[model samples]
Target: MTDPARSALMSKVKGKNTRPELIVRQELHALGGRFRLHRKDLPGRPDIVMPSRKLAVFVHGCFWHRHQNCRMASTPKTRQGFWNEKFDANIARDQRNAFDLQQLGWRVEVIWECQTRKREQLSASLKKLLVPPENHR
Candidate 1:
């Protein structure tokens, strides 16, 4: 690939609701769950925000968010240390964000990119999350 192309790819690599996020959002909407998307004021800008239920979801990419023990999360050989540091920071920040949100009384759920690979299962799981505990019983 050309240098400009590589640069463009890196530039577009952001930390936000990507394809997986959109997929989850679509499933949740179909399940009758209404929520906000990427609220900047929120601690982590959660991908899904259900105020009445006080639940926040962070749809994480397995590679970018570093899913522990996941094969797809392996760091690139080139600049290994830099990738490790960045991935570690992402995990730490995710923990801190979830902790802060919980302390403020918001329940947090993390969905991984690998999970999205199993769309049917992920859809069912997301439905479970969206459903109120009382309603489940």
Candidate 2:
């Protein structure tokens, strides 16, 4: 596609409140996970923040975040150099953000877009993550 078309398409990509994010939010809420959205004070402005649990969740897009071994993380045949640099930067920033959050005593979880597609699995995995250690059997 032309540059203008590609730019327009990319512009339409929502940074927050995306479909996958909304799905994760719903699942978390169903599990009685009370949370805040995008806390600016935190590194990476996590998608979901549970202050009581000191947990920060990032809902990452497979393609944008370069989810390893994920089909969604395909590379563009054209603009190879540009895409590589962009993906590398995204990965680096994610690592830095997670490290910073960890240093601040916050537990971080990353929910991939592909993972969100299966609601049952996502809910189960979230339950495990959100459940308190004392409650786990």
Candidate 3:
């Protein structure tokens, strides 16, 4: 695709309410997890926040967040330099946000887009996330 075509395609991509995000949101609701969406006051405006639990969840796209060993996280065939820099910045920002959230006493969990593909596995993981540790119980 030409540069203009690529730009237009990328422009259509949304910042929120993406397919993976919707899947996660639906599952969370099914699992009885109540969360606030994208609280601007929080660092990185986490996708889901449970204030009572002091937990923040981020539903990250594999390509944008550079998920390790994920097929969906392939680098673009064109613009290697630009993509690398963009991916690097995104990773850095994610790290910074996670660190900030932790410092503020919030436990953070990141759910990759690929993980949501398998409903059973995702449900198990979500159960673990929503459940307090045995010691806490």
Best model number under lDDT = 2
Candidate 3 collision pairs: none
Better of 1 and 3 by lDDT: 3
True-structure lDDT of candidate 2: 0.96
Off by over 4 Å in 1: 1-5, 133-137
Weakest lDDT window of 10 consecutive positions for candidate 3: 128-137
Among the numbered candidates, top TM-score falls to 2
Comparing candidate 1 with candidate 2, which one achieves the higher TM-score? Answer: 2
> Per-residue CA lDDT of candidate 1, range 10-108, in tens?
999866668888888888888888999898888988988999888999999989888889999887777779888998899999999999999998989
How much lDDT does each candidate structure score?
0.87, 0.96, 0.93
Error of 1 at 26 (Å): 0.5
Model 1 global lDDT (CA atoms, 0 to 1):
0.87
In candidate 3, stretches whose alpha carbon ends up further than 4 angstroms from where it belongs are 133-137
Q: Quote the positional error of residue 62 for candidate 1 in Å.
A: 0.3
Ranking by TM-score: 2, 3, 1
Q: How would you encode candidate 3's per-residue C-alpha lDDT over 10-115 as one tens digit per residue?
A: 9999888889889999998999999899999999999999998898999999999999999999998888999999999999999999999999989999999999
